[model samples]
Target: MPPQVVEAMQRPMVPHRGPEFSEFYIALIERLKRLHRTEAEVLLWPGSGSAGWEIAAVNLLEPGDVVVAGVTGDFGDRFALVASTFGADVRRVELEWGNAIVPERLDAALRAAPGAKAVLLTHNETSTAVTNPLAELTAVAQEHGALVLVDAVSSAGGIPIEFDAWDVDYLFSGSQKAWMCPPGVAIVVAGRRAWERTRETGTHRFFWDMDRNLEMTKKGWTPTTPPISLLYALDAATAMIEEEGLEAVFDRHRRLGDMTRAGLGQLGLRLLADDAYASNTVTAFFPPDGVEARTIIDRMASEFGITLAGGQAHLASSLIRIGHMGWVDDEDIESCLTALNDVLESV
Candidate 1:
């Protein structure tokens, strides 16, 4: 976390029901709305990004409802699972793990699964380091008259998302990724259609109820006690984002991604995602011919004190992911690349 975020979190607490807290909550929601580039209703929940998936499923879907999920990686599959758990018949458009989902494929899937209530998508699949074409995919879903729910957990703040322009029905993200804050808060943005579904759907929910959250939010309060410290951290982080300008922040992430990908390529390392669909926040790549992913990760940590993530599920042993999201810069990417280069040479 950044120093400002840390300092903000360290400040003393305030009464959750008081006017001061209400004002703070209202302002934070506005900032979050600005970040999302939407005037839609934004809800704050005390949970991780995974909770956002459940929130979307429980509130918008009923038993036996057909939901089409574009499964590109682990997160996308998890989202489909969440919807299935909530009794939605989730028909997944499974793609290769390292590739982004194309619009034509989604359009075909929707055609096959007629009367699908919603389409679940991951804006950026961190597992594969691929950013899906959200706008085009959303357009296709809309054409099929389906509500579009997006998991923007890894891309929201780092990547440019025009929520209103795309007519996205619902989108959610967590505080830890590009928000530059500690984990705990799940940020949800819902449009008119999603709110309407919440009222008509009979999926049982209490804590993740969108209706109750909306009622309380109008009064500048949350239905339950929130993670105040994380909110403080986010408040500071959003201010920092505002000061830096969203366009500039996005440009920096793009530059960092390009630098990391170019450096890895120069070292003869292969990126998992194609250049056209590569994520600006995280980059996934394969290890050298004989080097193990774990060996590279361990050596990078033990030698240079730089921690990297291994891939999920089936790709666990073959892929390594390097995060270049919030609180990162050109120098940081350069350092990580330099250390990775050394680790490969020594191995």
Candidate 2:
């Protein structure tokens, strides 16, 4: 977490219903809207990015609605499953684990399922460390007259995501990832068309209701008691980003990503993602010969006090993930690389 974010959290707490809290909430949301580059309503929830996925499903989809889901990695597959679990008839467009979602393939899938309510895609597949070509894919989906829903949890704060300019109908992200905050908040944006659709065919909804969230937020409130301290942290993080300027922040992430990949290459490790599609927030790499991914991750933490993440599901034992998002600097990257070098030599 950023130092300012931690400091903000350490401040005194205020009641959720009080005027101070309400003012704070509104200010935070406004900053978030600017960050998202959307004039539409942005909803905040006391939940995780997974909760944002559920909100997208429950609010925008009805039973038996056709949904075109592009599954390129774990988070993508999980979003597809969320739609199916919500009773949507999901037409899955599969991609290889480390590959990106091909726009032409998505276009063809949308053509086949002309009546798809929405084309669901993950902007950054953290599990595979690949960032999909979102603007192009959204254009294809729109050309087919289908709404575009994006899972941008891992990309929003680190990369540029213009919700309105890109014509995304629904988009969701977490406060944790690149927002430089701890978990417990989800940010969701619904475009005008999506809001209209919600009014026309709103699914069974209660707590996660976007309509309710919008109304409450307008009045400077939330449907339920939100995680106040987390909100404070997020507010501070957003300010810090604004202070640095979004362009600079984005540039810094890109530079760190390049540094990490090059460092890993020099160490004779292999990146799982292609250079063109590599995620700015994280990089997934295959461990060296005769070494387990978890072994290096553990060794890095124990030996150098540097933490690293391992791949999920099928890639768990095969790859390691280095997260360069949120509060990460060149020194942090160098420390992680140095630790990996030591571990690789020993193991």
In angstroms, the error of model 1 at 239 is 0.6
Give me candidate 1's TM-score against the actual structure. Answer: 0.99
For model 2, the local distance difference test gives 0.90
Q: How close is every model to the real structure, measured as TM-score?
A: 0.99, 0.98
Model 2: weakest 10-residue lDDT segment is: 195-204
Q: List the residue pairs that clash in candidate 1.
A: none
Model 1 over residues 1-347: C-alpha lDDT tens digits?
89999999998999999999999999999998998899999999999988989999889999899999999999999999999988889999999987999999999999999999999999999999999999999999999999999999999899999999999999999999999999999999999999888879887789999999989998889999989999999999999999999999999999989998999999999999978999999999999888899999999999999999999989999999999999999999989998988888889
Question: Number of clashes in model 1?
Answer: 0
Stretches of candidate 1 off by over 4 Å are: none
Model 2 per-residue lDDT tens digits across residues 16-123: 899999999999999999988888888899999889789888888888999999999999999999999999999999898889988999988988997888989999
Return the lDDT, model 1, position 72.
Answer: 95
